[model samples]
Target: MLQTAVLQWPGRWTKKPRAAAPPQFRDSSQPASLTVKSPKLAVTLEPVQHEDFSSLVVSVATTRDRSAFARLFEHYAPRIKSFLLRQGTDPAQAEDLAQETMMSVWRKAAMFDPAKASAGTWIFTIARNLRIDAIRKARRPEFDPEDPAFVPDAEKPADEVINADQMGCMVREAMAELPDEQALVVRMSFFEDKPHAEIAEQLRLPLGTVKSRLRLAMRRIKEHLGDRA
Candidate 1:
């Protein structure tokens, strides 16, 4: 009786049939239908032309232009930093000195007379004064000019002095090989301790040209002395 009942219920009648899927479905393997493209940007930097301070100082002081002050800051900030560094100041202190120097320049812009001193000389003097003040405030021992005990060690031997003289002569000869303009300014600035403006006036050259000549001379001197020193 059980076999007869199972036969009557067929396997197809017991199973559930799935409904058909909708026809609009698409395959996932294919790429998306749309894409986006961004346009490339072109960057252009305008050439910057710096005004020469030697020429602009009179105008800047007269007009009191903020741009001129900006130019001054740009030029002297690094120089003051370098000056302080040379004096053995730490970086933070040197940065502070530079800031102080710039502040002084801003306040004293009216004092900047191109006729009296070149920009470099004016800036150097500011740094030098600051350095002097710093040294003075340290309260180091004061040297007595008349005290024999405080005098420099007795001069080196005559032979050593002669040798030094010979080396100096050789260095001078090397300096003689420099261009006349360069050598002349170097000698005046270094040996005579004359300001660049005075040197320029004496040489009948533009102050900028005088500075350029002196810089070239110094570079040459440094190159020549490198091995000797």
Candidate 2:
């Protein structure tokens, strides 16, 4: 069954909540920014097409468009529930968590950045995190605050901190030394947090090519960081 209870506006629980006003968009004549990875590693953010799911999320974020939220709820709730069920959650819990996940989407809509992730990626990440949290909570045991072993660890020594910083700089320098194609995929997969398939689609490369580039990049980075790593 579709979980419609959390889809309604707060304090307005009903079988069918009233639809909100349609989302508004800026004039099409104006330039919009959307970040995309170019062959040269240059980035320019083109405007997302209106039919894109990212645009729907943007509508909800910018306008508090209940209609857009409803559409998102309708689309993602079932998928999230199924995802939870596959992870071994009880059906009732799955249904409830699905509703909670959508509610989180509604609340955290403003945090969604299309430049960083596709709508499905961002939404599913939330669902996955909620599931992980549920599992952890269920398995966690009570702990005493006075337990000496529970104390936080001491801060790293100054030398260790300096070494870590130097290592990070070296890693970044190594990344810069990569060929443009390899570097582009590395940034997309690591910095942008995109999956291999999404990176392949965005770059218009074969899946094998993407994997090959990543593998080559990792090998070079490892070679560069040899002793330190």
Candidate 3:
């Protein structure tokens, strides 16, 4: 009976349904570049712009952002260093001054405003004030008016004072006769206590040339004031 049922079975076969592809995956052979062009999948990039000190200062004060303060420090510190250097300060001292200036800026960050002055002008003023203070401190000497060694009780005669004033005038006249550049170097070297090498560096001249120029200037002055001393 079983054999007879098998013999009567249908000749056609039924097909099974296939599973769907995953939502994220694509066919390996297909190009992925075409899929990225879809507007919904595209990424948009914006350009980055740099901010100046005024803008950075406002941002730091208003937003309490440390990065903005850093930007300002980076911009001004080197300029302060150069200023000190041009004033005849050594690199180490100039760097210290620059650091001090930057510290002052950080402390006074709240005082900065775009309308009052530019960052460069503000920092230059701070450096200028510091330099004046330094000069004053250097020039201030302890004075004992009555000290026997330091002060003389008897004043010089009117004639002697007149002679000294005349000598000073003659020296000034002699200096005025010198070529402008040579006179400037000599005056700065003598009156300002600037070393010859420093003067040379400041004026951007060779050290030998500075020495030769100074020597010539002194010789001329001595000739002009012959026997005056």
Candidate 4:
């Protein structure tokens, strides 16, 4: 049996036999008979042309439209509940979390801005955030301040470290392949961190000549790097 309850402004708790289309929740102006489907879920989600769902939210915020809010709640509650259940939350807790998530939607409706995000996107984010908080609260680990191992290690992704090492190797190999004069200018400019003008003065080369050599070295490096597919 499927039952949906709207707490703030109550709606009839419709009941249906097993294997039925999802519940119907009508908006102030638009009634939703949404049919939402995914690999993990197959629920009723009537297709309504929402060229502008943001406007629907506006109706609720400005006019206190219960119907408008009801439509959003009915459509999303099951989806949110299912998502939480998939994450290993108990059935009772999942239902409660879904209700709380929709309740938050109603409370925070006035803050919704169409310019920033669509109604669906905004509501989904709210559900996700609430789910995270609920899970964390449910499974909070004990911590002791005096424990030496209590300090969490900062983790850099292995891929990022590997990429950095690869780039360094490429640069070294590229420099080794460069002519003596070009390599010297490249090294002083990049490795020694010397200014181009200073390098020109120290090497007794004109400024334009130094810049031209550095440009040539960069072009060679780019060529060595080759184009990605």
**lDDT by residue for model 2 (1-229), tens:** 2211111111111222122121122222454322232233332223323236777788899999999888888778987775555444678888988998999988999999775567777888787677757754644344666798887546865543334234444455566566656655665563322469866765567799889989999988877766333
In model 4, which regions exceed 4 Å deviation? 1-52, 138-229
Query: Which candidate achieves the best lDDT against the true structure?
Result: 2
Better of 2 and 3 by TM-score: 2
For residues 53-158, what per-residue lDDT tens digits would candidate 4 score against the true structure?
A: 5676778888888988777767778877755654446688879889998888778889887654567667777866676577655443457757987885457465
Candidate 1 minimal-lDDT segment of 10 residues: 5-14
Prediction-by-prediction clash tally: 0, 4, 0, 8
Which TM-score value belongs to model 3? Answer: 0.38
- Model 3: lowest-lDDT 10 consecutive positions: 4-13
In terms of lDDT, model 3 sits at 0.55
- Model 2: residue 148 alpha-carbon error in angstroms: 27
Looking at candidate 4, the ten consecutive residues that score lowest on lDDT are 5-14
Q: How close is candidate 4 to the true structure, as a TM-score?
A: 0.40
Model 3 Cα shift for residue 229 (angstroms): 49
Candidate 1 local lDDT, 21-128, one digit each (tens): 211211224532211121121111222122266445555667867787787788779867855553446678779778887787777768876644566567777766
Better candidate by TM-score, 1 or 3: 1
lDDT of 2: 0.61
lDDT for residue 75 in candidate 1, whole number 0-100:
77
